[model samples]
Every structure is written in structure tokens, then in C-alpha cells.
Target: MAGKIRVLDPDVVVKIAGGEVIERPASVVKELVENSLDAGARKITVEVEAGGRRLIRVSDDGCGMSQEDAVMAFQRHATSKIRTAEDLYRITTLGFRGEALPSIASVSHVELLTREHDSDVGTKVVVEGGVITQLSSVGCPAGTIVTVRNLFYNVPARLKFMRSPASEFNYITEMLIKFILAHTDVSFTLRHDGKDVLCYSSEATGGDLRSAVAVVWGSDTASELIPIELSTPKVRISGLTSKPSLTKSSRSHQVVILNGRFIKHQGIALAITHAYQKTILPNRHPVCVLRIDIDPQLVDVNVHPTKAEVKFANEAEIQRLVVEAIELALGRTIVVPTIALKPQPKPATVKALKRAEDAFGKLLRSKLQIGTEQTAQTDLTASKTHAVTSAENVVMVTTPETKPSEKHVGIGISGGELVDWHEILMSLHPVAQLHKTYILAEAPNGFCIISQHRAHERIIYESLCQKETRAKAVQWLVTPITLNVGQAEVNFVVEHLEAFSSVGFEIEHFGGGTLVVRSIPAIMVNQPYAQILRDIISELMLEQQMRTLEELIDALRASVACKSAIKAGEVLSIAEMEQLLSDLSKTEKPFICPHGQPVALTITDEELRRHFER
Candidate 1:
């Protein structure tokens, strides 16, 4: 028999459509809170129990609904945000989909109580699983209070997919933080399990967003941020960005607000990253609360179901403005890195050994057998290695031991002390820094240039790797330092406490979103251990997505290498350059950084002569 097609039941259709908007407990919070914001609410309260699975409540002091409007609000496709099709294009409110209320009501047991300021009585509507069970007049305050119980109870399949209580709560906590940051004029209070978790007053800062940021991310981090405001003929951008010295591992710290709504756009993020090119490390991202205002007609906010993503008609132009804004803010910084250089005696000899540099070096050389001694100095182009180009000379080799996503390159160092000029590093006397970035040296081959950051990164990476494999001991602190982070970061630290301990960090909870660091790794001594640890944790969080415990330690090594490495734009003394070259020669992979960036490049004397036509 042939199968016949039939339309689903009306109730089943409503539930299916509602599931799209109310996929998880966090989704419910987003819709209801956005409704509160759009309703001209001055104060909003959010309470949840059992990670929003058993109960969810949202109350607001705003224009409450009338008896008639309260009943129709739960019907599908009913909205007051807009009326005509033209209104959709110029949406200024946070929510205009007309699906949140009805969709939410269809999936959970919902109770709505509302009373206008002029109304003598309030309306009470009880709905269970998209069906209206009761409706009557009730006494209530002026505003709206929505209570949802047993979310996803009607759909056991959806309920089965919910994450752990703590994880779900983390998502809700993060969402609320974003809303609070976006609206400084609205007072927000959040409670979990009957305990007050967050209480922010709108009047506390006099409408200052930085004060609001301070309340969430801490005062020290707030103080380190720079203000950004730029205007073009077509677009305007205004926001706050942390200094280059302050960065996190993930892009999660960056919040991109499009027009008046929160959105995620890759083009804008790329523009900001390009602006911080040489100042911040590649793996780290700056914390920014960027708001871009463009003509509503030039953007589309209906791209995603949750409205977290948006598309711009002139994306390239908008990206340009984002870069210019960040650059303008960074240009005003008086960043003068102080470098201490002590005079060191020059060596009498420079020589090369025929044997490989290290155990790893031996294996690399024997397996690749890349070039002969005579051609080694001449084959400097990118093709001889993996994706090695003439411009960058990058060769990324991936091994089982290394991260699959990370690129790696092999380097050859002329081993042993020298009595004669046979080594590349020593033979090429390092003269000066080129724009305070690359080291200019006179090499026997022709010229030797070193990337200061990559060179230092290699040295530190190898040192940390050794320490990790050897079960390094912690260097106890005389005065313990306390680190302040957000609640989510604190939870992450608590969960990975043992991982930190394995890397020689002795930290413990000190109550109130603070962790006291009693000791740290010996290699990270004399540096800002607190900032370093934070960076390490940030890096670990990213790597944890695809890495195991053993792999996490390797990722930690890379992070420590980047953090402790000497930064670009730093003035180096002659002695410092001498020591850098000397120390670099001793590392296992002297020519490539841990992240596979080239530490040094050499141009042969013959190639130089050919270019000169000599």
C-alpha cells in the first residue's frame, strides 16, 4: 500500500514551532528577558531553580498588559513589537519575532499575571503545554510576572538532552551578564536556588557602562581598558577595549553589539584582531565591549533564530571602521616597555658541529634528510619545507605528540662552543633591532634576522616542556597573591585545580570569586605570575575542547612560552641581544617557535651578491 501524506495536528504543530524558540532553559531566559527590555522595563528580576529545569521566573516593572492583551499574548504569531512588513527592516527593539511568548508557553507550564498602572484588577492566565487551563482576575502589583514550571516536561526527548544543572546554569549566568552589560540604564537582579547571585543597580553608575563592567569583570580589569569611539560618514562605532597587556585566551570576552542588539560577526572580530597585530600574541584576544551603530536599513538581524548573529550590507566598510576605531584607541596609549641590559663578555670563537642538535633534532634530520651541508645555507626558500614560502618561509609539520591544529617547523642549530667563525648565530653579529621588532645581524651566509618574540618563545617553550615532564616543584610565595575573575572562570579553575597543580601552580579558593596563589613554577618567577596563570587558564580552556589531560599540559607549555616571551616593540640592549642569540642556540628547535612561526631567516652571501649584481 502507498503511504498517504497528512497534516499534523494543530496542537502538535504549535509545539514543534515552539520548540525552535525554546530549545533549552537558557533560550527561555533570553526570550523573556529581551521582552522585559523591549517593554520599557526599568527594573527586571530573574530567578531560577535546579538550573532552570524545575522552575524559571521573570518579573518586570514596566507597562503591564490589559485583561484582553494578556489572554492573546500566548497565541502564536501575536506581537506588539511591529505591525507591517516594513517595520521588520527597521527593528530597534531587542525582540520583534512575535514567537517568544507563545513558543515558550507551548512547551512548559506557564502562569502569567499582569496589571496595568491604571487598572483596578489584574489578569491571571494559567497555561499548560500550549493549552489554556484557567483564566481569571487576580490582585497583583503594577507590571508583569511570568512563572514557568517543569520546562520540556511535555516533550521527554527534549528534556533528555539537557546538560548538567551547573553547566546549564553557567549558560544562563553568561547570558544575563551580557544583558546587564548592554543595558546600564536598567536595574537587574538575578537569583539562583533562592540565593541572590547578582544585584546590579542602574543608579549606581549614573548611566556609565564602565562602572557596570567593573561590577562584573572587576575594577582592576576595568581600569586597564581604553575607550573607543569612531565616526564615519555612514557608520559609527563606540566601545571599550582592554590594553594589550591585558588579554584572554578565548574570544568569549569580546561582546559585539550591532545597532541596539547583540550579534556575532566574524568580519568585525577579524578587524579588531588585525589592529592588535604586533602588540598582542596571536593566541590571545583582547576583552572588548564594542557597539557598532549602522543605519538599520543596511543590516539584517533576522539571520539567526536566537538573533545572536547579523549580516551587514556593507560588511567590508563596517570592518574598516572597527579596525580604525581600535587603532585610534590604541594609538593614545603611552606604552613604553623598559628593558634591562647588562654588559656581557663576547665569546672568542664560533663553530659548528656535524652531529644533530638534540634527540628530537636527530630524528628530524635523519627522517627528512632535507639538504646537504653546502646547500643547507642556500636552500632558504619556502618550498624546501611544508608550505614554506619565500615571503614568510613557513613550514608547518604536524606530529602525533603536537596539537593537530597547531603548526610546527624544524630548525637546525650549529652545535658546540666555537674557537673559529663557523656558526651562523655568532658569526652573524647582531647589530640592532629593525623597528624594535626583527634583530638585524651580519651572518657568514649573508644576513641573519631573528623574530624577537618567536626566538624567546622557543626558549621558554622548551624550558617549560622540560619542567612539565620532570614533575617540577613549586616555588612557594612569601606573600600570596589573590586573583579575581568572573564566576564562570572561577568554576573553571575549581574544576581544573589539579591540572594547574601539575604545572606547578598552587592555588586554592579564597571565597567570593577569588583564588589565592600560594606558589608558582620556577620558570615563571620574577614575572607577573597572576597574569601568567590567568593566561594559562584561558589557553587551557580553549584546548580542553579537543585535548586530553596529557595534551592539556602541552598546551599549557605553549601558553607559558607565549606569555613569558619578550614582546615586540621592546628596546633590547646589546648585551640582551648577545644573550638571546646564545640562549637560542641551545634550544631543541632553534629556528621555529612552538606555534610554528619562524624564529630566524638567513639569506646567503651568494644570493645577496646576485641581488646586488656584484
Candidate 2:
């Protein structure tokens, strides 16, 4: 059988392993960022061109490695972070695997320029396709600068899977945001094609996380945060969250960190969503940045090669701690009133009026005063001629009493004050709530529906969303509420001060794990403020497991809708129903509310007839 198969090349085996580490541009970004963090770089800069497809440059002012260490860095599994199997269980460094550098070098053209602080000369190395082509001594700054080019050149299939430059850039930006959130004390700058996208500088204050977040996300987000400080024998949790009203339609805004490492945890996300339940609409997400600190032995960071997900020894306890922290922080904040505003009606078009006239010609014409003067003039002329022929200077003419045509009358009412109301209702007809959630009204052939809550939610959402980036309008409360929480919950509250203020909740940290609440969301002013906040937090904790802050916000909006919606059994007057119908007709997606639930239902005339069997 010719001794089975020929032996595989060692170079090919290395190249295959490289494929596992460097999958895409985002993968490259992750490796480079981790390397910078490991280098003890207080400041780092990343620049990309062509969405990192053409070039990727990372420069850092960390204590550069010696010539020997720099040369050994390109070898697989060569790491200073770990010495044995036990070290893997307790990893503190960001890039402990050491495979990232070697793996990356195997797949692309890489150039490294690094010099130790004590060395007068730097070492330069160039590697292409897993082969070291050059190594030389050169004079350079006391730092390291790595440039990678032509990624996946050997693998055409992988290159083909790359997305457009814009999309790839978005991914890079997202990765940058994660790093920025994780290491707020480290100043970072990012540029795309020589254009600065982000420039963050850490603050001397302990809240560098918030400062960094404000720079990348916006100042408004920082303002909405309520300070959270929580500690326990087993765990510590802290971070910020957007108020229920500041929900978004996407998860782009949520950031979570586990033990100083950025990660995406479904359990934590679901907890946040649970907290915002009944406060935000469905499908809407909120803005949040949370960090969890726990004993190193309690969590496993080696579950994934990328370390973006982790398994905790006591996940349930961690979840409880996080939820409790957020709940307690919210309880201390004052609840303010949120005013709902009605949307403006669209102006009537000439075509619409013409259509109405065509449907009921004489009735519409009479009601609108169209051709009325001409009819009166013709009647007067005929009466004058008849009067001239009369002998006693008075015309004794028999005239029939004119009755209004049914077709000429508008819909709803016959006459009196109800006439205007009837006309308005008729003009707004073919009204139906689409998806049983939003109201849809006929407009020419097509129709529009209103998302009663989302429309209101959007308005509030926008205001709160902006507060994270800009100065927000704040309302004061008359009474200050006190809330008691554990240590970990306090940390979470402090992390999200700006997010809280944006939604009109004002709070201050009182001594000994107590928060003083001064204001709350205006919409929920009449309700039990403390209890509502507590419930929201509890729900947030539950939701954090499955959703991000943005998703949680949506859940909260739905919660608010349920509490504020018109009750099902309540009777509505004709005018009230008409108004509701008209409003529903104007909405964009009136058939469905923020949640997936329908806002209204419809029974066709045929279906009604069938049901009655008339």
C-alpha cells in the first residue's frame, strides 16, 4: 500500500495551529490589545488601515523585552506568564498563553521593534509565513511597536470570508470599547486610517472607568450611572446601568467585565433584564457597564482560548450578589415623574380631501362649504324673478322644505357639537391596531400605526440616552429616601451615576453602605418609588443572565406599558375610543407594543357576521 501516507511538514502543522488563533481582523485586535496590557503599558495606541486587512500597527510605551526574550517570543508556547499547570488555574496576566504572538506570526508578515529600558539599542525581527527572515540590532525608542500585514495570505478561503471595510472597522471599534472599559487606568488611543476614533486619558480619581467610558461612549452615559459599592466574603460586584427609560433597540451599549477581563456572560445579562422588567418595552435594550470581582479560584478563565467567557464556581451566588447590589442602589434613588406627550397629527393632503369628496360627493361638498355659495346664488336669482311678477310687492311662492342628504353628512353624528367629532372620526377610519399592538389607520391605500408606548418610550429613551453623552435636565424631589444594601451593591451604584441621573433619579451615597435618594423618574412618581426601584433591580438581576443592558431596557419598557396601559375591562366612551383609534392609526407599528404582545385586535365585518349567524 506504499506505506500509507507521506509525513506532514512541520511548517504546515504550525500554520494550521496559527489558523486557530488568528481567525479575523477582530482576532488580531484582541491579541495586540492583550499584549499591550501585558507589557505594563500605561499608554497604548492602535492604528488600522483597510479595516486591518492591509495593515495593523500597535505601539506601546511599556518596558520592552530584551533581545533574547524578543527573539523567543515568536516560538509557540513560550510564555513568561505561566510556569506550570497550577499557574493556568490562576491567571492574572491578559496574554498568558504565549501562543498569540507565535500563532499570529505564523499566519502573516510581522515586524517587531522592541528595546529594553536599560538597552541603548533595540532588536528588530521580521517573520513571514512562520519563517524568521531577519533579525538585527537597531537604535529605537525604549518601547515596542508591532506591525502586521497581509493577514491570511496563505489561506485564500479565510481572506474571502472577511467583511466589508466598514463592517470590519465597526468590529475593531467594538473591541476597542471592551478594552477601554476593562482598563480605565491605562490611557488608550485608536485611529483608523490615520483618523483618530478614540482618545482616552485616565483620571486621577478612582473612577477612571467612568471617565474612560464617558470618553468612548459619551458623557451622557457617565451621568446616568448610579454609584455602586458592594463587597462580600465570597465576591465583589460593581458597575453602572442605564435607567429603565434609557433603553435602546440593540446590545451595542452594554459592557461587562469579569475579574478585570472583559467578557460576555448570558447569566449576568439576564439579571439586568430582570431588573428592568415592566419598566421598559420589549426588544429595547439599556446602556450598562458592569464589573464583577471574585476570588481567582472560584472562576475558571481557561474555558475558552479567547477567555471571553468564564465559568464561576458559585455562579448562583454571584448572580444574587449582583442583583442585590443593583437593587439596593436603585432603592436609594428618588423616583421622579415622567410626563408622556402625544404625537402631532400629520397634515391633511389635497388628495385625501378629494378622495373623501368622491366617496360622498354632496355630503362632503356641503360639509366643507364647497359650491355652497353658487347654490345659494342660483336660488336667490329664481326667487327675485318670481317676486317681480307678484302684484302686492310680496312673492307668495310655494317652496318645498329642503332636507339634508344622508350621504352629505359626515360619519359618527348627525349634527350639533358632535358634527366636528364625527367628521374627525370618519376622516381617520379604516383604523386598526396592527399585530394587536400598534394602531394602524388607512392613509390613501396604505396605513400607519402608532407604538403608543415606544413612541413615548423613544422620546424618553432619547432623553435618557443623550444624558449619557450630554448634560441632562434634572428634576428635584421633595423627600429623600434611604436604602440599605450590601457592600457589592454599593459599588454597582457608584459605577452607574450618570445613567441614573439621566432618567431623573438622583441619589447620594450615605455613610456605611446606605444611599440617599433624592429624585426618581417622573412617570412613576405617583407609584411606590422605592418598591418600584427595588423590583426593577430584582428584575434586572434576573434578566442580566440572558440579556444586556439594552435588552433589559426594552424589557423595562414593556413593564411600564403593562402598568400604564388602559385596562382591558374599562369602558371607553365614543370620543375616548375615537381618540385612541386616531392615535393608534398614526403610529409606525401600532399593531405591536414595545414587547412582542399585540396592542389591539380586529374582527372583520364578515367574521362578525359569521359569529352572529345573521
Candidate 3:
């Protein structure tokens, strides 16, 4: 009889251990690059071919290892960073476990060339599938060079799970960015397929984080970044945070480099959010690059394999430190870019644009019953077009100041999709504004109530939808508005500028995470165009926000309508009320707004009787 679990072979054990550390080319790069930084490397170069499936070479100019040390490095649990068990509690170096080299070598063919500065010659060691195949003395530079080839060739299962070459390369690029941002003292050059993709020279700025941020995010964002510095007994925090105006839709732009390694802490994130609560909206996240130096004894880096996560002794205190530092930095500066719009010569086109804007809410002459009541008829037809504008829009509406005549109006949307709702809305006679928020109306059956804000939101939403074509009205900003939104949004905007153009926004990339807006949808021109751009980008960047290219234009329309819609507290004249209800009747979904909020609620005669117990 055999035991259910037999001891695995040496090769099997090494390969299995390697799987834990070397998941992809990015993982390989992460481990090797950290080793270079740990060796006090001043210059590091990473080269990849075929997204690291063919080869990955990481060369660093630092203190290299001797021939004996080069051979011993392939063995597991051998490390110069630590010696005893007690050292695990106070782990300071990035590569302390000493498993990175052995694990990487076990799953791939590796060649290491190293020479100390005082040594006349260097040693070359080659490893294949967890075995040292060759070791020889060679002449080389006074540094270390690690070349990995045919990664995961022995593990066909792992190779099958690899993503596309470009995707894998992107992952590698993203990982390198973290290392580059974490260590600004070292110069880094990354090449893919023999083309220089990114380069950073440490010769300039001498470890200025703002300069690094300028390289990664952009100079515009770096210029506006506020420096934060604070020292406590247990924690020292120093880094840069974006101004109140410069923020990202997501937290990916926020980075917390703990000690010398990048990490994520929920308490720290909440602290950042709390600090900027008064300045930014709840949904928006401020961009930050913070380095928190704390006593090693208080942190447990052994909690994760990759050391991307850490455990703090006093999380609340650390969070408080971060919050205070950021808040203090924010209080110290009040600088924002100001733009002076270039004056445009007012021509006949100006009047034409105004008239077009005014015509948005101006209803064409039509006969419809104001109410289903069989009482009387009054002449209230004199006031044809009256401005019923909100504080945010120049909407005009047609109403009666003279006489009333029989007029007609006419949605099948079961909320998600479309049904017939206009018949019921058309019959309701608006009585008066209740609390200046809702409109009370009378019906033949019982009565109806409408939320003025939601009703206008629906009206505006449909109007924007109707105008979502090349025929859209474009309001050109005299002086192009430039916005520093960040790398992710910049990539998105550049890739989908056509989507923006299709809906009437003429935006172009102005280099380095900055966008210049030449024009915007005429409907949203009066609103804060920059903020609108930010908000739209914010919403569109949300997970699953865009399903197809068509939805891109739809999102623009919806965002613009929501911003341009009338709100509560604005007093509406009778003409405005009638025009609003009349417009709502014409929409595809009159029962609910674009956001799915109820525009109007109706009580039938039966329901009213039941409520009153009549």
C-alpha cells in the first residue's frame, strides 16, 4: 500500500515553488528589478523580446557577486540580506526571502554574469530547468546582468494561460512604472522588441519625485502637485498630491509607497479620501504619490508573497498622519490655472446660435386640452414663447397669458424599455407648484404629481438624444480649454476622440495626459465645460460604463442633459409649467428620467378613494 501523498521529486518541488513567484514575465521583471535596486544599482536597463516569451534581460550597474556567490545564488533559502530567523521580523531589503532567483531559474533558462568592482575578471553561470548546467569565468563589466530565456517552456500548462503579447508587455510596463516611481535615484531604460519604449535619466533633478511624476503622469499634473511632508515619532510621510481641481475618476492614480516598496492600505486610502472630502466630490479620487517611512519593527512585509501588501502596527494612527500631511499641504497652496477666452466677433451666426438655443424648449403651436375637465374654456394663448430658463440653462417655453384652447399630446417604456404614457400626462391639468419642487396637477380620474427636476431631466435627455448626430450643434470655445486629466483618461480620450466628435465635442490630445477642447455640444456650452469634460470622463471610466462605441455617444448625451436640466428651487411661470409637461409628453419614456428616477406619479380615482376611505 502506498501513501496518498508521496514526497514530490526535487525537480517537481522546485518547479512548484517557482509557480508561486514567477507567474508571468512581469513577475520575473519585478523580482529581478528589485534585486538590482537592493544591490544599490544606480542605472538599470530592461530589454524584452516577444513580450518576454523569447527573452528578458535585466542589466544593472551595481555591486555584483563573486563566482562562488553566483553559483550559490541558484540554491533556495540562500541570501546575504538576512542570516537568522529573528531577521524576518525586521526585514528591510526588498529581496530577503532569497527565493526569487532560484524560483525564476527553476521554471526558465537563466544566465547570470557578475563581477565586483575590484575584481579583474567576472563569472558566468547558466541554469536550465532547476539545474546548474554550466559555470565559467569570463571578462565582463563590474556589475550584474541576468538573461532569462524560454520562460515556462517546461510548464506547458502555464504557457497556455499567458495573455496576448501586447497585453503581457503592458503588464510588464505597468510593473516597471511602479519600480521607477518608487526609486527616482536610479536611471531606468526599457526597450521592447529593440525599440526604446521608455527612458528616465537620474542625471537631472537628483531624485526629485516631481520630475519622475512629470515623466509618468505629465508636467501639467506635476506642476499643480502639492508637496506634503510630516514627521511623527513612528511615521514620516513625504510625497505629492494633486490640487482640488486635478483629480482622477478612479484610485489607480493614487499610490502609496510604504517604506521603499509600493503597497495598498485601506486605512490610508480612507484617510486620503477624508482629507479631500471638503474639496472634491465623493465619487472623485485625488491623484497622489506618497512615501511613508516607518520603523521596520512595526510593519509585517511577510504578509504577502510579492510584498505588495503590508500589515501596520497602528493603522489608524498611520492614516491620521497621512490625512494631516495632505490637508496641511492643501492648505498651503491655492494656485489654479486661469484661462482668458479669446473674444469672438459677433456676427449673424451669433444671433442664429442664440435663436437655435432658445428654440430647444419653445413648443410649436398646437391645440391640446389643458385638462380633462368638462367645465369651461378661457383664452390664454397670447404669451407664445417665454423664457423658462433655469440657473443652468437658457431654455424657453411656449405658454398662455391670454386664452386656452383644446390641445392634444401623446411612451411604451416599461422603465428599462419603452410603452404609451403621453395620453395620461396630456390629460392632467397642472394646478400649482408644491414646495417649489413638485408640480401638482388635476386629472379626470383623480390627480397627478410631477417632480419638476426629474421631468426636466427627461425632457432634456430626449432632446439631446434626438440631436445625437453629425447635425449636432457645436459651440466653439474661443480659446481652447486645456485639461490635465491623467494618463489613463488621456489614452482613453485619444483613442475615442471620434466618439467625442460624433456627439459634438471637438477635443484633441495636446501631449502628455492633457487635452485641448476646441468646442463642445451646444446644449452644454453654458455649463462649466471643463468640469463637464471631467465628469463625463469620470463616468465613462467606470467599470462596464461603455459596452459599445454607440454607447459612448449616448453617455455624452446623458451627461450633458443631466448637467443642463432644470433643478428644484427655481420658480417656474405657468407658461414654463405647461411647456414642461407638454415636452415630457413627447418623450420616449415620460414616466421616468434617463437615470430611472420617477418623473411623475399618478393616483387613479380608485386609488384616491381607497386612500381617503370615501
Q: lDDT winner among the candidates?
A: 3
Across 500-546, the per-residue lDDT of candidate 3 in tens digits comes to 88766889887656788888765554456677777687566554232
Of 2 and 3, the candidate ahead on lDDT is: 3
- Expressed as tens digits, the lDDT of each residue in 535-579 for candidate 1 is 776655444353456766767767767776777887776646765
C-alpha-based local distance difference test score of model 1: 0.73
Measured with C-alpha atoms, the lDDT of residue 14 in candidate 1 is 87
Q: Estimate each model's TM-score.
A: 0.69, 0.60, 0.72
Ranking by lDDT: 3, 1, 2
Q: Looking at candidate 1, what is the lDDT of residue 154?
A: 83
Task: Point out where model 3 deviates above 4 Å.
Answer: 1-19, 22-25, 48-56, 105-111, 123-136, 148-171, 334-351, 356-468, 471-524, 527-614
The sequence of per-residue lDDT tens digits that candidate 2 reaches over residues 172-254 is 76688788888888887778899776667764534376666666655545666676668998677887777665655456567
Candidate 3: Cα lDDT at 105 = 94
Compared with the true structure, all predictions reach lDDT values of 0.73, 0.62, 0.75
Whichever of 2 and 3 has more TM-score, that candidate is 3
